[model samples]
Target: ADSLSCVRILRKMRERVSESISKMKADMSRAEEQARREYERERRHEYDSAAYLISMNKQSAEKSKAALPHLLTMSDHLGVDLLHLSGSALSTVFDMKEMSSLKS
Candidate 1:
Protein backbone atom coordinates (compact mmCIF):
# COMPACT_ATOMS: atom_id res chain seq x y z
CA ALA A 1 0.00 0.00 0.00
CA ASP A 2 0.98 3.61 -0.39
CA SER A 3 2.22 5.79 2.42
CA LEU A 4 -1.10 7.58 2.69
CA SER A 5 -2.93 4.32 3.00
CA CYS A 6 -0.52 3.21 5.64
CA VAL A 7 -1.14 6.38 7.59
CA ARG A 8 -4.90 5.93 7.35
CA ILE A 9 -4.64 2.37 8.55
CA LEU A 10 -2.42 3.44 11.41
CA ARG A 11 -4.87 6.13 12.46
CA LYS A 12 -7.77 3.69 12.40
CA MET A 13 -5.90 1.13 14.44
CA ARG A 14 -4.88 3.78 16.96
CA GLU A 15 -8.46 4.93 17.34
CA ARG A 16 -9.74 1.40 17.87
CA VAL A 17 -7.07 0.60 20.42
CA SER A 18 -7.65 3.86 22.28
CA GLU A 19 -11.40 3.33 22.31
CA SER A 20 -11.07 -0.22 23.60
CA ILE A 21 -8.74 0.82 26.39
CA SER A 22 -10.96 3.75 27.31
CA LYS A 23 -14.06 1.60 27.55
CA MET A 24 -12.23 -1.01 29.58
CA LYS A 25 -11.28 1.65 32.11
CA ALA A 26 -14.49 3.63 32.29
CA ASP A 27 -16.66 3.56 35.45
CA MET A 28 -15.66 1.23 38.25
CA SER A 29 -18.47 1.65 40.75
CA ARG A 30 -19.01 -1.85 42.17
CA ALA A 31 -17.82 -4.41 39.67
CA GLU A 32 -14.27 -3.21 39.94
CA GLU A 33 -12.69 -6.62 40.40
CA GLN A 34 -14.62 -8.13 37.54
CA ALA A 35 -13.73 -5.32 35.23
CA ARG A 36 -10.08 -5.59 36.14
CA ARG A 37 -10.02 -9.29 35.40
CA GLU A 38 -11.75 -8.78 32.07
CA TYR A 39 -9.34 -6.07 31.08
CA GLU A 40 -6.40 -8.25 32.04
CA ARG A 41 -7.69 -11.08 29.93
CA GLU A 42 -8.18 -8.80 26.97
CA ARG A 43 -4.69 -7.45 27.34
CA ARG A 44 -3.18 -10.92 27.48
CA HIS A 45 -5.01 -11.98 24.37
CA GLU A 46 -4.06 -8.91 22.41
CA TYR A 47 -0.45 -9.08 23.53
CA ASP A 48 -0.13 -12.78 22.82
CA SER A 49 -1.43 -12.44 19.28
CA ALA A 50 0.80 -9.48 18.64
CA ALA A 51 3.78 -11.33 20.02
CA TYR A 52 3.07 -14.18 17.70
CA LEU A 53 2.90 -11.85 14.75
CA ILE A 54 6.17 -10.24 15.74
CA SER A 55 7.76 -13.65 16.03
CA MET A 56 6.90 -14.62 12.50
CA ASN A 57 10.43 -13.63 11.54
CA LYS A 58 9.22 -10.68 9.56
CA GLN A 59 9.32 -7.78 11.99
CA SER A 60 12.05 -5.21 11.46
CA ALA A 61 12.86 -1.54 11.67
CA GLU A 62 11.65 -1.15 8.10
CA LYS A 63 9.07 -3.91 7.72
CA SER A 64 7.15 -3.12 10.90
CA LYS A 65 7.76 0.59 11.05
CA ALA A 66 4.11 1.63 11.14
CA ALA A 67 3.38 -0.76 13.96
CA LEU A 68 5.80 0.52 16.59
CA PRO A 69 3.53 2.95 18.37
CA HIS A 70 0.46 0.80 17.95
CA LEU A 71 2.26 -2.09 19.54
CA LEU A 72 3.63 0.17 22.25
CA THR A 73 0.20 1.49 23.12
CA MET A 74 -1.34 -1.94 23.04
CA SER A 75 1.46 -3.29 25.18
CA ASP A 76 0.94 -0.40 27.52
CA HIS A 77 -2.71 -1.32 27.85
CA LEU A 78 -1.47 -4.81 28.60
CA GLY A 79 0.74 -3.32 31.32
CA VAL A 80 3.82 -4.69 29.66
CA ASP A 81 6.79 -2.46 30.44
CA LEU A 82 8.49 -2.02 27.10
CA LEU A 83 10.87 0.27 25.27
CA HIS A 84 9.97 1.83 21.98
CA LEU A 85 10.62 -0.76 19.30
CA SER A 86 11.60 0.32 15.77
CA GLY A 87 11.25 3.94 16.90
CA SER A 88 13.51 5.49 14.29
CA ALA A 89 11.91 3.42 11.59
CA LEU A 90 8.49 4.60 12.65
CA SER A 91 9.66 8.19 12.50
CA THR A 92 11.08 7.65 9.04
CA VAL A 93 7.73 6.31 7.87
CA PHE A 94 5.98 9.39 9.21
CA ASP A 95 8.61 11.67 7.77
CA MET A 96 8.19 10.08 4.36
CA LYS A 97 4.47 10.61 4.64
CA GLU A 98 5.00 14.28 5.37
CA MET A 99 7.28 14.67 2.40
CA SER A 100 4.80 12.89 0.18
CA SER A 101 2.04 15.22 1.34
CA LEU A 102 4.11 18.21 0.38
CA LYS A 103 4.51 16.86 -3.12
CA SER A 104 0.83 16.01 -3.52
Candidate 2:
Protein backbone atom coordinates (compact mmCIF):
# COMPACT_ATOMS: atom_id res chain seq x y z
CA ALA A 1 0.00 0.00 0.00
CA ASP A 2 0.98 3.64 -0.37
CA SER A 3 1.34 3.91 3.42
CA LEU A 4 3.82 1.04 3.55
CA SER A 5 5.64 2.44 0.56
CA CYS A 6 5.90 5.77 2.37
CA VAL A 7 7.38 4.03 5.42
CA ARG A 8 9.90 2.17 3.29
CA ILE A 9 10.90 5.37 1.53
CA LEU A 10 11.32 7.16 4.88
CA ARG A 11 13.50 4.29 6.18
CA LYS A 12 15.68 4.45 3.09
CA MET A 13 16.01 8.21 3.47
CA ARG A 14 16.96 7.87 7.13
CA GLU A 15 19.55 5.17 6.42
CA ARG A 16 21.09 7.25 3.61
CA VAL A 17 21.21 10.47 5.70
CA SER A 18 22.30 12.59 2.77
CA GLU A 19 21.93 16.34 2.04
CA SER A 20 18.31 15.70 0.97
CA ILE A 21 17.09 14.85 4.49
CA SER A 22 15.12 18.10 4.59
CA LYS A 23 13.58 17.33 1.20
CA MET A 24 12.79 13.75 2.35
CA LYS A 25 11.04 15.16 5.42
CA ALA A 26 8.89 17.30 3.15
CA ASP A 27 8.19 14.26 0.99
CA MET A 28 7.09 12.32 4.06
CA SER A 29 4.66 15.10 4.96
CA ARG A 30 3.19 14.95 1.49
CA ALA A 31 2.99 11.17 1.71
CA GLU A 32 1.16 11.42 5.01
CA GLU A 33 -1.34 13.86 3.52
CA GLN A 34 -1.85 11.60 0.52
CA ALA A 35 -2.57 8.65 2.80
CA ARG A 36 -5.00 10.74 4.86
CA ARG A 37 -6.82 11.95 1.77
CA GLU A 38 -7.04 8.42 0.39
CA TYR A 39 -8.51 7.23 3.69
CA GLU A 40 -11.05 10.05 3.82
CA ARG A 41 -12.07 9.43 0.23
CA GLU A 42 -12.69 5.75 0.91
CA ARG A 43 -14.62 6.51 4.10
CA ARG A 44 -16.76 9.10 2.35
CA HIS A 45 -17.55 6.67 -0.44
CA GLU A 46 -18.58 3.94 2.02
CA TYR A 47 -20.76 6.40 3.94
CA ASP A 48 -22.47 7.54 0.76
CA SER A 49 -23.11 3.95 -0.32
CA ALA A 50 -24.61 2.98 3.05
CA ALA A 51 -26.74 6.14 3.13
CA TYR A 52 -28.04 5.45 -0.37
CA LEU A 53 -29.01 1.87 0.52
CA ILE A 54 -30.76 3.05 3.66
CA SER A 55 -32.66 5.68 1.69
CA MET A 56 -33.75 3.03 -0.80
CA ASN A 57 -34.88 0.64 1.96
CA LYS A 58 -36.85 3.46 3.58
CA GLN A 59 -38.41 4.26 0.21
CA SER A 60 -39.44 0.62 -0.24
CA ALA A 61 -41.02 0.59 3.21
CA GLU A 62 -42.93 3.78 2.38
CA LYS A 63 -44.17 2.21 -0.85
CA SER A 64 -45.32 -0.86 1.04
CA LYS A 65 -47.07 1.33 3.63
CA ALA A 66 -48.78 3.24 0.88
CA ALA A 67 -49.86 0.06 -0.88
CA LEU A 68 -51.25 -1.71 2.18
CA PRO A 69 -54.65 -0.05 2.00
CA HIS A 70 -54.94 -0.71 -1.70
CA LEU A 71 -53.82 -4.26 -1.12
CA LEU A 72 -56.46 -4.69 1.51
CA THR A 73 -59.15 -3.49 -0.85
CA MET A 74 -57.90 -5.78 -3.60
CA SER A 75 -57.61 -8.66 -1.19
CA ASP A 76 -61.26 -8.21 -0.32
CA HIS A 77 -62.02 -8.80 -3.99
CA LEU A 78 -59.45 -11.62 -4.54
CA GLY A 79 -60.05 -13.47 -1.29
CA VAL A 80 -57.46 -15.89 0.18
CA ASP A 81 -54.72 -15.69 -2.46
CA LEU A 82 -54.26 -11.93 -2.19
CA LEU A 83 -54.43 -12.13 1.59
CA HIS A 84 -51.47 -14.53 1.66
CA LEU A 85 -49.63 -12.46 -0.93
CA SER A 86 -50.05 -9.29 1.13
CA GLY A 87 -48.91 -11.09 4.23
CA SER A 88 -45.71 -12.16 2.53
CA ALA A 89 -45.18 -8.63 1.21
CA LEU A 90 -45.63 -7.21 4.70
CA SER A 91 -43.05 -9.62 6.10
CA THR A 92 -40.48 -8.56 3.49
CA VAL A 93 -40.83 -4.90 4.44
CA PHE A 94 -38.51 -3.58 7.11
CA ASP A 95 -39.81 -3.42 10.68
CA MET A 96 -39.08 -0.67 13.22
CA LYS A 97 -35.90 -2.24 14.52
CA GLU A 98 -34.65 -2.72 10.99
CA MET A 99 -35.34 0.92 10.19
CA SER A 100 -33.50 2.02 13.31
CA SER A 101 -30.55 -0.17 12.43
CA LEU A 102 -30.45 1.32 8.95
CA LYS A 103 -30.37 4.80 10.42
CA SER A 104 -27.45 3.89 12.64
Scored by lDDT, model 1 comes in at 0.41
Summarize candidate 2's per-residue lDDT along 1-104 as a digit string, tens digits: 99888667645533443333344334434544554565565566466766556555554454444444444454454342333433343233211122222111
Residue 38 alpha-carbon offset, candidate 2, angstroms: 30
Q: State how far residue 46 of model 2 sits from its true place (Å).
A: 11
lDDT of 1 at 53: 47
Model 2 ranges with Cα > 4 A deviation: 1-47, 86-104
lDDT digits (tens) for residues 1-104 of candidate 1: 69889788666644656654343233211133444455465566466765444433222222233333444576676554324334454334333221121100
